[model samples]
Target: MAEVKLFGFWGSPFSSRVQMALKLKGVSYEYIEEDLPNKSPSLLKYNPIHKKIPVLLHKEKPIAESLVILEYIDETWEGYSIMPEDPYERAMVRFWVKFLDEKFLGAAWKACWGEGKEQEKAMEDAQEVLTTLENELKGKKFFGGDNIGLVDIAANFIAFWVGVIQDVVGINLIEEDTFPTLFKWSEEFLSCEVVKGCLPPKDKLSAFLLARKEAITEAAKSIVYK
Candidate 1:
């Protein structure tokens, strides 16, 4: 039997992505929940530079970054494919995953967490990112076409976490009518059994996000007063 261990946080989409991929591949892993503020010693040892969660330890070798872990899971495991077979298709998947992690997620976070003029600018940027994704998702059930793949896994943040954070902040960036295709994609993605099983509870996630929002607001007020 293979020894597989995963260090992750329940509320993080990045962590959930790794979980979803491992589950999709039918790979059983020991899950260790990490406290983000005070990360575990093993997590620090494994992912020293990033010091982030969703680090996969297979046979004692560590792999950091959710996207990188997903690719590793696909290549190492002998079950369902998480990435496409064709080279061009794989390239496209990599492109969209990069876009989601590096571009879209940042804008979405700022839109939910920023204030005043910064919030306004972030909302516009997030909307533009959504529009691009909406167009890409047009006529496709999933970014992987028929099934979940690398891009779909990478997009877990947009499909779920962002929505929860937006609700906590009382903002609506991913409207169904506005981004119909993307909305439909989210629905279809969440409907999958693998995804449903890996997701953190909605009520719990909402509470966590609400607390984070309050903390941000309080910090801002303190900065203003100071």
Candidate 2:
């Protein structure tokens, strides 16, 4: 077997996504915990473009970016495929995954971390994204149907971190009535064995998000008032 290794931070959803895929596929690997505040030389050397965690090393060749790592793992491993075999189905899965990563995540990040009118607009945008996803999720057990796959893994943040962020920010975008499907999806997604095992402790995540919110708020104010 080739030597496999993963560099990641405990509290990051992106890192958790990779961890979930590995666990689901029964792929064993060495895990290196990276301190985000003080990044390691190895991490910096491996992911020069992003300089971020969740870098997977397969026989010493590094793959950066969580979503990319996910597809790579599914393709390389034999068990529990994370994507559809059909081309159009695979494309649709990629579509929502990309939407969550690019647009939804940014808006959700801003909603929890932005200030004043910025925060309001961010919440609206995030909700809009959620509405679209909820529509897509109609009659589906998971994002890809019966089993959790690419889209569900890509949306791991909405299932877990968004709740902590809401608590930290004192705002609620996902409620029982407001987004019933998403609310149900979150419950089901988080309860999955692989995901449950990987979620960061809620209290710790809450504390981390509070500090992150402070940094974002200060940065937003500095940009506007400066």
Instruction: Give the best candidate by TM-score.
Output: 2
Write the residue-wise lDDT of candidate 2 on 137-202 in tens digits: 989889979899989988988988888888888889778799888899889998898989988999
Model 1 over residues 1-226: C-alpha lDDT tens digits?
3499999999889899999999999989999999989988999999999999989999999999989999999999887998888999899999998888777776777777778886787789888888888889888889999898888888988888878877888889888889989888999999999999999999999988777776765554322100
Cα-based lDDT at residue 2, candidate 1: 47
TM-score for all models, in order of appearance: 0.94, 0.94
As a whole number from 0 to 100, the lDDT of residue 12 in candidate 2 is 89
Q: What overall lDDT goes with each candidate model?
A: 0.86, 0.88
RMSD (CA, Å), each prediction: 3.7, 2.8
TM-score of 1: 0.94
Candidate 2 accuracy as lDDT: 0.88
Candidate 1 residue runs with Cα over 4 Å from true position: 217-226
